[model samples]
Target: MLRASLLASVAATPFFITAATAQDYFDIGEIIVSGGLSPIEANAFGRASNVITAQEIERRGLTTVQDALRALPGVSVNGSSNSFTQVRIRGGESGHTLILIDGVEAAGGDGEYVLSGLQTANIERIEVLRGPQSVYYGSNASTGVINIITRKGAIGDTYTATLEVGAATTATAFVSRRTERGGVALSFSHLDDRGYDQSGDGGEKDGLERTTINLSGDYLLTDDWKVGFTLRGSDEEADTDPSPFGATDADSYVVDDPDEFSTRDERTASIYTEYEMMGGRLTHRLSFNKTKYKSTYSSGLPVTRESEAVKYRLSYGLDGRTVADTDHLLSLLVENKKDSSDDNPLYAREATSVALEYRGSFANGLDVQAGARFDDNTVFEDATTWNVGLSYQIPDTGVRLHASAGVGVVNPSYFELYADAYGYSGNPNLTPERNESFDIGAEFAILDGRGSFDVTYFNETLIDEITDVATGPGAFSFVNQAGKSDRQGVEVSGNIQATDALNLRLAYTYLDAKNPDGSVEIRRPRHELALGATLDTFGGRGSVSGDIRHVSGNYDSQFWQWPAPTVELPSYTTVNVAAQYELSDTITLNGRITNLFDDDAVDAWGFASRGRAAYVGISAKF
Candidate 1:
């Protein structure tokens, strides 16, 4: 394993970037919104999580949401180098990581979900909760959850616009206005990239284009009543690539076929109301959410696939802190959701769930939390899940210890249950995959809150996994496998402020993911490392930052092709750097370079990675 030496080398480089100058840190606060039913201080939570703010995005010159996610703990991405793709947490499949836009689930029925199209134009912050969250998020949260919160209009009028040109061209604009009783914000962004070639031999560049728009508004109807709505939509189109079958009839990817292309349209809408009752000790929230998605892929030949899904969700939640004074909290949630699609019976499914949670803090610096949920699915039997956690802080010191455990379940997808293609048939009796996960960790900070460290050990076992099995001669169908997979690992992360204006950060993951047959899971790096640094430079008027990532090779197999067998997927490393300069009171200049080493490594054993590239942009506001 090329893990130890390589990882150590990368981890040690950040220290050298420490600046000699001392500066002040941007104070945000030690708070996390997704770790609990409500907002909680980071030091009081007995779980592990990472937060990325919009200011950090701008400082780092992160162009896409995917780029930002790759830096987080336990995130892995595939595809999107040329076309749409999937991203998973830890060693789980893409479907195991539940994605939310403003607390509303966005995954749809067997098509390109909006995961690839989100433009980060209106995002205020992103919260990543690692480990099983099915008790709170319900379906498809067996591994982790990514909650994206967008900006509500500020208390005053604001407007900003930016335009960039490079290997990819981008445009972004935002406007907002607010009064004492109400506020509204609107954002629009477009990206067009003449991306790298996708063919094995490299012939034509697979271009991609996307446009996204977001609108959000909130109104305070009365002293203790408020209502809000969030709306988002995007359009995307991409050029071609081929399959691994090399010009054979079995090759569905149509290799190097520039004539092959795909198009997608997606929309998400949600509205919510909040009311305070019982002398301000109790509060209730009700929300309605819906997502509409459609996608089509066509090749030069007479082959094309079109799919669509519309999902609707309704939820009501209650929260109170009067159970045992302000030290105790209680939460209740009820949700109903449905997915519908024409020409696909399995896509027509419904689910309902109820969840309850309680948290309390003791005078001795001890915190306890527990939650339970019951879910009923139209296509599967009812299931119950629960989670518990504990946190303790050593008095007067910046040391804290924590532990958490949870159960998770994921219902079968529409394509897995009903798609009939390539000599395979869907199985109506398929059941959901169940998981039990456990995690323990400790966090400590020294040097007057300038340095911090965290170490966590996590393990998960999956049961009743749905897989294809031979049903008859020359035919295969979906069935439940008793034991599917296991994932266990250690995560280490830290940050140190070497100087007042310079900070160094590092994160590493050691993963041991195995299939039921004792083989390693595909596309999961056994060892992953990330290193970063931010420094005040150019006379304090400009700042510069850079990050490095290293991945150890894993295993993969090309299904639906001849000689399908697990093969080694090579590992690689890439670096990114960015610089910003304030040109004036209302204008700023920014520049960035991606893949600094020009690795051009094959990404996830499919497409070629972008080589060394640079871009410069300017932003203006009045």
Candidate 2:
């Protein structure tokens, strides 16, 4: 299995490698940073994790991060449009997952990051760590973490560019440069889609126009010091439909209104410095991150809403070998964050946190990890979280066992605490939600490392869940629930190098999510399955890959109906195929077809999904 190969490689490397330098080789997926304070090998990690390498993204012709994540186990992605995509994991709410870019928080004041705005240009790799992770990442990490790592400077100068045209009148241009000491990347994408009638009837097209820009660079100050920065911005104008606020017919809520449109602008930036000390035994890092969001709605009162978030963090790590064939790492972190919005000038929240983590690896094929964190908040009750895990490889047997348990916390979002819109009131007395979770998994290597299979079972319970309650006619307020919500699931995956020229992969998930009253949760499918195959053609100079995903047994609510009626959504299946051929040493030709069969399956009752579409593109390296 690949995990065995990764472990063997890590066992041969040095005790510690600075995080800044590790980025140079992130494509290997041998070291993972999001799972712990310090980088750890995949074999030693006790978490259910998945990685999407840059090569895979390019091979699949994925333009957005959300597209790359759609087929991953335990992950579900859906949206009404390109500007409102949401990602959920393991039956957890979208806000329960933390989004990170180069160790910087990418979420807004609402504690959620819309995945549609994140492009794949200049991305080195993506890491998904499943389970409660508040002990390592603080709030908004009640279920998992998605860490997006960008490409770093290489040994020499290099330049690359790509141009593509696709369905929906989409056009994209990307360019990047890498130097010995530093590197920079830039990308721009524009989309003008003549969307379908979202109401499932003939009507005006709900079109949309969106533009995105991403920039990043880093420079080495010295042999042991480095500085880097990233900037991302996006603008979107989307035609929306009228709600059922005052409509006489409940089913007319999804009808399109040409005059009802919304505009949004989002920006995020981060700067950081890293310095190694004590001859590489100790490392220190300092970073500052900021995100801003602005939106205007033309449906009701031409209302404008704006929010901003700022975070400052500092951390130190010490690495050493205390015993023969053993390694130990200890880390400490301190951070301060503030979230505010112009809608409520007097409503802002600040939080300070301190955390400690320890990781140990021994020659007896056992790895252990533990972490704890304490958070101080100004608006809600304080929280403390802890986690522990271990992984062991049975010697002489091709089996590995892993298990982890953790406590997670999520503070109420600013909107939930201060918003006074559409007859909904905020609840300042609401407390943070708490979660307890555990998972156990085992992996088996078969066919002499040519094939691998794994299965895991996870269980979680959430307490003090924030929910809306009706107070009076057309009035509601947020409040903590009295009972706990339960979630349990099983995940299975397999990989096989079937032949020297072909590879196959499969993943399936079975989930059971329940509300406090033991009722089925909405939007979480009970069964999801994905199958993929890749073939190397032209004697390794060209490649072709195809993927299929199926989702079934999902339910959603019709919010426009009084007392919101729970409805089951129809199952969906999507197919995508991509191929790339190397024209020369510096040029490549590529293309892809999405939704090959044009199955018009809607994730939501009133939302219409895209049909079969094809794209062609060219890329060059110099």
Candidate 3:
């Protein structure tokens, strides 16, 4: 009842709606990278997309990439802690989404990237493309793609530094230098937290310590040639509570254990070169990427696991004017990837792929894009995917119509194919999962272009879904489900420049996702809403921003109970506020408070969420 009332109230409010863009409301001239191999203007892109710039990240006082991603339309995030964060898009599974750092794939062996360890200190921008993107990205792109672009060299020499201290004993330091042809950046972050007991009983606090470091640099060989590299490493140690499996006392389901803790270490590196020729109309790029992940868990028996992946990619693009008032671009790509793990000898896989894409823009406000890809796998069936989209703007009406459709594929992971573990065995005969999806939307320029509103509807069907089936008591095996799972949703967003000094933004999503058996999926909220406001004060020297988010009607499984009954999680609302004041031309002071209301919303079953916290920091540029 409360959820319904809130939704109704927000819908009736004229100021509540906005598309996720840069600081402006629906800036059609903005350039985006994830839309295609080449950067394309938002006006010509057909897919539902969002862009969060570095300036916005700083204004909002967001520390991590995951924090900046929350409250976006058709996106949901949940996990037990920062070390295990998972992101789901358009009701798709966590493994169905693909993550890219400067055009390099960043997923682990399981085809999923943990966003908890990605900091925003040196990021330039984040672009999110919703819907199936396998045509260009190949496997593990059944749902969507998140592309993170880091800072690069500036036109002249410059230096920057930042220092921050916050709640939970958190500290951060960042420094960078940029020359005419190259630049380098380094950042270190640490956090020590004394968390509340998840079991709900008064007991010892669960604690955690985490540290992360990032280094990146790039150099320009010539006006049309460039080389760059990025390296990142993170280490985390957290005290964890035991699961509900085999717990005798109800209070013991999620009790903290001093002896139970986990540690994780992750490292990633990428090197790439780009060259342009044919009067700057043709371009070529080659890149190599590698990632390593290791984890150790201590809970009665100590266990450790490790995984690694390597990828090589080469691509070329040709741009020309095919028609009098039309622009065309053709792109070709070839890639090879390999994955391995220490868990089992058979847990190794490799694949090679070829892909082609085309994009065209007309002078009459019409744009078209199409792409196709083929992948050959060593241990699974070969797969093919395709996608097409278009967008049109009506002359002088301030209205734009867009639509997109695509087919995506996701291969089985190494662990799923050859795992030999306690009470669980892998299935080698499993085939790849497939998804078919489409979305249509319209954008309206309202209030004489001072505000904008957008409405989008998306539908998807997943075939050959992967799941584990019980073979006997205390035993299970991976298998492909027979039928298809369905997901559909509506996303509404808008923004209004209320005045010269204030801006308002709103977004709401309604999702209906079901399993093959017509049962509701778990951990996906049916309703999500967000409201935000920013005000510039003190003659533009000071600024303040506040945001409110509400989530409701999500479900989770109680693993402690027999048969693992599913239960609904309590609805939750959280508020965040930030303020910044410029003290000098090159110095600034900033502070923020998160979860101001301290709503204890359980995202995963039996896990206690974090409460209110505050942070303050200073930054300087020289």
Candidate 4:
């Protein structure tokens, strides 16, 4: 299976590498981005950070944010297809990374992280900061923060559009418009394919459709203060056979029809007000948001579920540049969530949280930040989280030393605390999981920040962990285990711009995870490596790019190994490539190939990955 996935990825590379591209040069580094600070500033001050700008997205020919993150170090991303992607940072679980779109939290009632609602088409840039960030972000940010900043209207009225066709019969269309007053964007994407099978017959196949619409508007309200609104909606559908391992007959194995599997719909609305004063030194913001998520499973009983969430926040900031540049921020938030399941035990949950944060840069090129959060959940008594971090730059050289420590809590999700799905029951007595993490790191920039290296060593300890261990009656329930789970790891990643024509990015991560029960956590890899580069030629008119990703074998469980002693998911590597051509000032063309090596990596117990694929696309501006 691994061989097939690799082979497929390799085979598709030629198409992307052979096309001619235009020299229209743009530097993402120059784009004005503010999640309080620019990406460069954030990277320099934060303990660990990764920035992916819109230009980078286009340069890499990435269709989704998940694909863009896969090449980064210490970030683990997995998906059955484009629509079911999930990401984990370091060794933390997927749900532990908080995803924010335009400063509003995107969470489902089931506590599932909702990255699916973000359309790459509408994003201006993304900042992925690693380590326990609950102090600044609150709650789910125990491991990291993925903040997606949406595009804003600055340039005069203009329109951007793109259409793509690829292997799997994949098709995507995107249209975006920007005016001095407001901006809007829309995208429609679908992928369908006959999959490759490892057992000679009955391989795996899937079909998916995703549609996204986004609207954003800003009225200057006298130049110093402005109020803005962001509204986004998306719907997705998928049909595929359950892993072929579940099929006993070859005919029953092929997903008979591509559109018979599952459906999901999600919508989000947010409004924000911003006022600037004292020469842009003081800023205040208030925001309100509502999100609704619905998912229906074709193969399950009860068949459907819906989750709704409403959240509001107020934030104030003050900037000063006296002795040392400094900023003080305060935020308060309230969240209410309700879920209706065909099986209603996991019915509803409400939570209210508050946080205060302060950060500043000193004259000696030292930066410090700290914050605390207090949360009260109707389910749990109370939980408090806090963190403090510092980064200092050494004199005369572009080297920086960083360190941080934090403690947090993850209140059990609805599924763990009160699910009645299928035949399983939830435990109302579940306690909030307590987590403590610490890290120390350093970064060195050579050749004027064009080439940089960063490394971090980190550790986390979880107490009173919750796990759904088998109890009795053919059901699983969440239990507060007595022992602690500890994980430690090292992450190293770098990018070197050897010359104007060549750029290279490399990353490697090693993890050590274990518990008192002697079981390794599920789906955690011990080692991962990634290498990517872009070569530009034809006077900046043509380019060639490719990436290689590798993951080490991992165990599935602590026990249950008999016939082959813990079936090992073998290590595998996949490659991707893209080429571009400038059709005119308003148009460009691109060709891409994925799984060029045709590696068919298996997932879970029954499903295998898709093989080699090819695609062609065009983008135009008006």
TM-score of each: 0.89, 0.90, 0.90, 0.84
Alpha-carbon runs more than 4 Å astray in model 3: 1-29, 248-251, 297-326
lDDT of 2 by residue, 388-453 (tens): 888999998999999999989988877788869889999999899998999999999988999889
lDDT of each: 0.72, 0.75, 0.74, 0.62
lDDT of 4 by residue, 270-371 (tens): 776655456444445555666666676554433334444444444444545211122444444455544444445436666666666565656788777676
lDDT for each residue of candidate 3 in 1-622, tens digit (9 for 90 to 100): 1132222211111111111212223342265667765556677889888888777788888777888888588888886653567888999998888987766666455547777656776676888889999987778889999887765424344456676666656666656666545567666777676655655566666676778777777666886677777787778787777775677544566776667777777777877776656534555667677777666654443222333333333333334521111267677777787766666554577778888888787779999989898889888888999998889998999999999999999998766788678788889999999999999999999989999899999999999998999999989899999999999999888889989999888888899999999988898889989888889999999899998999998988777777777788889999999999999989999899999988886788767777787888888766
Q: Per-residue CA lDDT of candidate 1, range 1-622, in tens? A: 1132221211111111000000112222345556655555566777678888777788888877777887877777666356766777768888788887776665454332436546666577778888888887777888888887766545568788998888888899989887656677888999898887765456788888999888877777886677778788878888867564453332233356677787777777877776656644566667777777666664432211222222222212223433213467677777787776544743577778888887777889999878899888887677899988889998888888988999888888666788687788887677778888889998888788889999999998888888888878888888888776999998888889999789888888888999999988887878888899989887777899999988776666655456666677677789999999999888999999999998755545554666788898998876
Best by lDDT: 2
Measured by TM-score, the strongest candidate is 2
Which residue pairs overlap in candidate 1's backbone?
A: 23-500, 23-501, 242-255
Q: Single out the weakest 10-residue window by summed lDDT for candidate 1.
A: 14-23
User: Which ranges of candidate 4 are over 4 A from the true structure?
Assistant: 1-40, 80-83, 114-119, 168-200, 243-260, 277-281, 301-346, 420-424, 557-565
**RMSD of every prediction:** 8.2, 4.0, 7.7, 8.5
For candidate 3, the lDDT comes to: 0.74
